[model samples]
Target chain A: MEWDWDFAWSIMPTLLAGFRITLIATFLGAIVAAVLGLVFAILRRSSNRWLSRGTSFVVEFIRGTPLLVQLYFIFYVLPDLGLRLPALMAGVIGMGLHYATYAAEVYRGGIESVPRGQWEAARATNLTTRQTWLHVILPQAVPPMIPAMANYLLAMFKETPLLSAITVLELMNQAKSVANSSYRYVEPMTLVGVMFLIVSLLSVIALRWLERRYGRVSQ
Target chain B: MGDWAGYLTLILQGAWVTVKLTLMGSALALVVAFLAGLGRISHHAPIRWLSTAYIEFFRGTSIFVQLFWIYFVLPMTGAELTPMQAGVMALGLNVGAYGAEVVRGAILAVPRGQHEACIAVNLTRWQRLRHVILPQALPLMLPTFCNNAIELLKATSVVSLISLSDMTFQAQVVRSQTGSTLMPFVTILVLYFAMSSAISFGMRRIERRVTRGLDGVR
Candidate 1:
């Protein structure tokens, strides 16, 4: 049918509430991705060949597959193995794990960009490996990573719509239910698109700011 | 293992559909990328504005929403598309928007001196683009284009929601039939990885061929 302004107004609150969940999932997922990515990057850099190769394989597997299927596997297949997660948790983890591969690559690049002299200097001072990583490496490497990491944060935010596939009450899912019951596809769906566009545009501006502020670190 | 042989056949059929969608969608994305990319750099104001709007609209929204809008909403407006049609369109258009930026960046990355050289030779704008610009820009574009293609392939998995019977959809079917979520899911996951690795490998070869004899510039 035709678009209706009043109908749109009536559904605004529900969609906004769904928007909150979408944002929360994205926020939590970004945190998970950042932390896990660091873990993966470090493990991949380990001197132990098996540990590094296994980490690399896992990262490539996650990177190669679709997030939607990963969510399915996490939500559905995990239960078969006696590990159950709430739908939102599964979605968040899946998003995080899927994007973590990309983040790991970013971290690897940042970590590698740290000059060999710095690593040598860390050893030259007789600093422990942990101390060297904590005091010298991460502090220098992490700033340059902020912009790239922020870009993934925004990317993950856009991808929150995929959470709807696992029955998460995110914006897209809310819009679908609204359209299903109300028989008005135009307004809810269009509004969902608009909501995503606005948030993404704002994130782009913020990412540009981040790049300007932190991108000079590696150089 | 013997029982899985039958399920494997079904999944392979589904993989075929996924392959078709990826191929068709990527071809469409490549065409749109060039058109919109060139349009973005065009001297005409309206062309540039239209291209920017198109790119922004597609890039800003999620591909899942785009697919649903085309699959669910479009039919209400009296235009009906088969699930496959909607899936391919959404994947192509969505990825094409991102590819356009890659195209624009690559073209812009061409050295200023090349453009100046074309101007000095009194080459027409079209000739400058055809003979001087794209050849240089193409090598740069290939790497990112490969990434975009893999992204589009992953995106086709979402079409399973619309009942497109791609690999993901077939996995769901196998899951329901055998009540074995792990097997079906793992099977499809491996299939996806294999497909993506193949794309990556092929693209690398193409990139090498394209960049041949241009190593110094790149």
Candidate 2:
């Protein structure tokens, strides 16, 4: 079959809309993750054993399972308890929550990697715990986390296709809808693949540069 | 949804398929990963580029989107494989990309001093890679390899979209039949949790055993 640029171009309108949703959902979801990860990472290292243990359990629980099923629970099962979130909201929530667990470990590793002498210096200066973390440790920790965080961001973008299962018409959903309605799987999916390739290649290049730049600083 | 008889039977069926696919797919991905991973770090520029391209293409694309392409596009292209084949192929390819990273990282993680030691001992390339490098890399790779294997298992649910009778598919089937979406899906969710947790728990034991050998080396 010959390639059909006209057909591919027409579907671009819907696909673009879906791409917007996918981008927003991923970007916003990543923000949630960055915050939740910091919270859980700190909680896991807290002085209180109960708080640390409880946070660890929650993180492990979320990380151990599939995001798809978790999203199903958020989107499908949650309504049973009379809390009906919008499909997009539920999707971002599920994706954010599931990835937060993984990101928390990343944060923990970043935090713990600070040299012990740094802590001693802060202590010697009579810095509060908050002051020490904000001033002494975090600035040292966050740069290395940037590349890892970028990887997660790209991963989250790829995962936006899953939100379609919950009726959020992200990129893949639009491609599927076009395929289903037009009875032409060839062009739309091909275009979708190209679009994904472009986006993710950009992600790779951006991530690589970030990794190299911050990697030098962290070391 | 502790309706034991119903959920148990459904999840059991899904669990069987999940385990089977994870094993089969990971097995395939591992074999290819070793080659591609080595290719990635090869002295030959073309070999390195080829592996890098392979990794980036799969890594960049959504696994579910790839699943759809295999399931939908391949049929239109006249390669009429089953849903299972498409599902397995997508997953093996996806995990293979990740496994390449693990393998390459693990190899690089080997101490540079060891490479000098191998050279000083007059070890051949194959001997150094097989007897020295890979042995050390295996233990380091195991934890990450197993994690990807579990993620692939969780990913098997995507095959349900193409009509594979996987766990998520079974859950969907049960939900539609019973008109009770929450219970059916909740049961499926718990089954995934149990299966993944079990995999991680088992791998953790193995990680401990592996690390035990390396203890006090530094």
Every model's TM-score on chain B? 0.97, 0.90
Deviation from native of the Cα of residue B103 in model 1, angstroms = 0.5
Cα deviation of A106, candidate 2, in Å: 2.2
Q: Please give, for residues B6-39, the per-residue lDDT of candidate 1 as tens digits.
A: 9988999999999999999999999999999999
CA RMSD, predictions in order = 1.9, 2.5
Worst 10 residues of 2 chain B by lDDT: B1-10
Q: What is candidate 2's lDDT per residue for B143-204, written digit by digit as tens?
A: 88878978887788888778788888787777766667777776777777788888888888
| TM-score of model number 2 | 0.92
lDDT score for residue B105 of model 2: 92
